[model samples]
Target: MIINKFGFRSNVKSVSLSVMDCSAGMLSISLFKDLLKVHKNSVALVLSMEVVTPNGYNGKVKSMHMANILFRMGGAAILLSNRKQDKHKAKYKLQNLVRTRLGSDDQAYQSVHQQPDEAGKVGVSLSQELLHVAAKALRTNISELSPLVLPYSEQLQHGWSVIKQKIWFLAGQKGTYVPSFKKAFEHFCTHAGGKAVIDAIEDNLRLHKEDAEASRMTLYRFGKTSSSSLWYGLSYLEAKGRVKKGDRVWKIAFGSGFMCNSAVWKCITNLDPNLRNSWSDRIHLYPVEIPEVCDH
Candidate 1:
């Protein structure tokens, strides 16, 4: 949870994405995206993350072990600016994104479920089918966002094919089609849900190992911080001084309800490498490849 410390509680409406899955990272970023667009020229402070142990299930042996190995406490705070005048100082531009929710099946939502057992110990269980749900949701979201961002040539060819087949219904009416995301954004911050989730997305998006390094590192360093993981991923880029003015970045996260949320952002300032945070501080102790999982 991120909050403004301006000494006025009433002025701030604490926005929280609780119990959100890995995709919450994207959802929170999308919220910031909307806020920036509405307030144009102002800065929006975004805080996101999750504390999963409080809801852990103790009786379920397999589930509890999985949770123990997969989750860690982590969060992040990011400042976003949308002012066009700030372009000179801006680090990146808000690009295009597509969000989609597939609640057609209750099972998909239940794939990664949280509940209590007979012993009253709460825990989360990830069904073997959860990955399938994620893949389906991602496919739907990409199909919707691809046409809009794809190059004109690719769009024309794909558009004509869809039109000829009366398959416009497949992409929907919003024109969500986008060309390869590589053409529109310089960096990618995928939610650090877990190794499997990250691997799945990397394969699906055709992202290079370097493109996913930030996310993987954050997950290894800080574990799954839920909605805030995406910001941590971005911070990795900033920490390395990789983000430059006018660069475009894309953030993607997954969450309950089997939803895929995305946000596109352009940097407004050169991030300070010396910036400090509870999360980043811990990164120093982490191994570059994979770190041991410790209970917090």
Candidate 2:
């Protein structure tokens, strides 16, 4: 609609969807894929930013305190194009997008919320159980992504692993082997929502120190930029010259409403130095020592 502000016609086709918090960005990617399927040569722009104005919640709740510390002030816009000629200029090509939700579960539904208090106070509320809920959502999301990105042999191994795990569970035993996602992606760009969230993903996915470097550095330098956090991670990797042609990058985000969403992209070319973002000047200093409480 803003195109009309520049004198463009309002007759352009549109499809809009609203998703929960950080998950909204990846959800946009999902919808954009649908739009591309319907129209051959269209492009979609997804803009995401954190809301820091009209500051909500001045209370002493721990979640509010954490939110104030984690959510920073920033935004990013991503362009998705399906045009053949555009490929030469595009940085990455869309691979796939997967979204998973835990709305049916009561605990998951109440994990992160905005509600009116009995006294009529309204502010975002986050539960202590959020990590637990997020872990569940993250697992579900990765499960969906496995089929799309995993190699044929990896998928077969995963299938057998699942069956073996089921048998172990039936025998009142536990299966410790979880498929390694490292082989599926060259770089991982996860939401820098919190140190705990990143740590949980690293542990769950069996990722090593370098695997989560981009995300950790993003949080250290930018705090948590909400939906744009994934982009920040990607930027960090880019600025560090870690991305290359044909490499696969995976972005995963966790948001309120216990949602987890993922988007995968394949690099079209080596990152151009001139195209590096704001982090260019400070990239070398990052992955800095982020202490437990680096209150800014």
Top TM-score model: 2
Candidate 2 lDDT, 130-220, residue by residue in tens = 9999999988987788888988887887777667767845555465457777778899998788788888989988899899988888787
Judged by whole-model lDDT over C-alpha atoms, candidate 1 comes out at 0.71
User: TM per model?
Assistant: 0.76, 0.89
lDDT of 1 by residue, 1-296 (tens): 12344564666546776666666656666777777767756766665667776765557567656776666777666666766665676555667768898877887778777777667777777788988998888878877776656566766765666575566455545443334567766898887877888889888777888888888887776677777778778878877767886677877778778788777777767677667644456545433756446322
Query: lDDT per prediction?
Result: 0.71, 0.80
| Residue ranges of candidate 2 with Cα displaced over 4 Å | 1-8, 13-19, 58-66, 168-174, 293-296
Collision count for each candidate, in order: 28, 0
TM-score of 1: 0.76
CA-only RMSD, every prediction? 5.8, 2.6
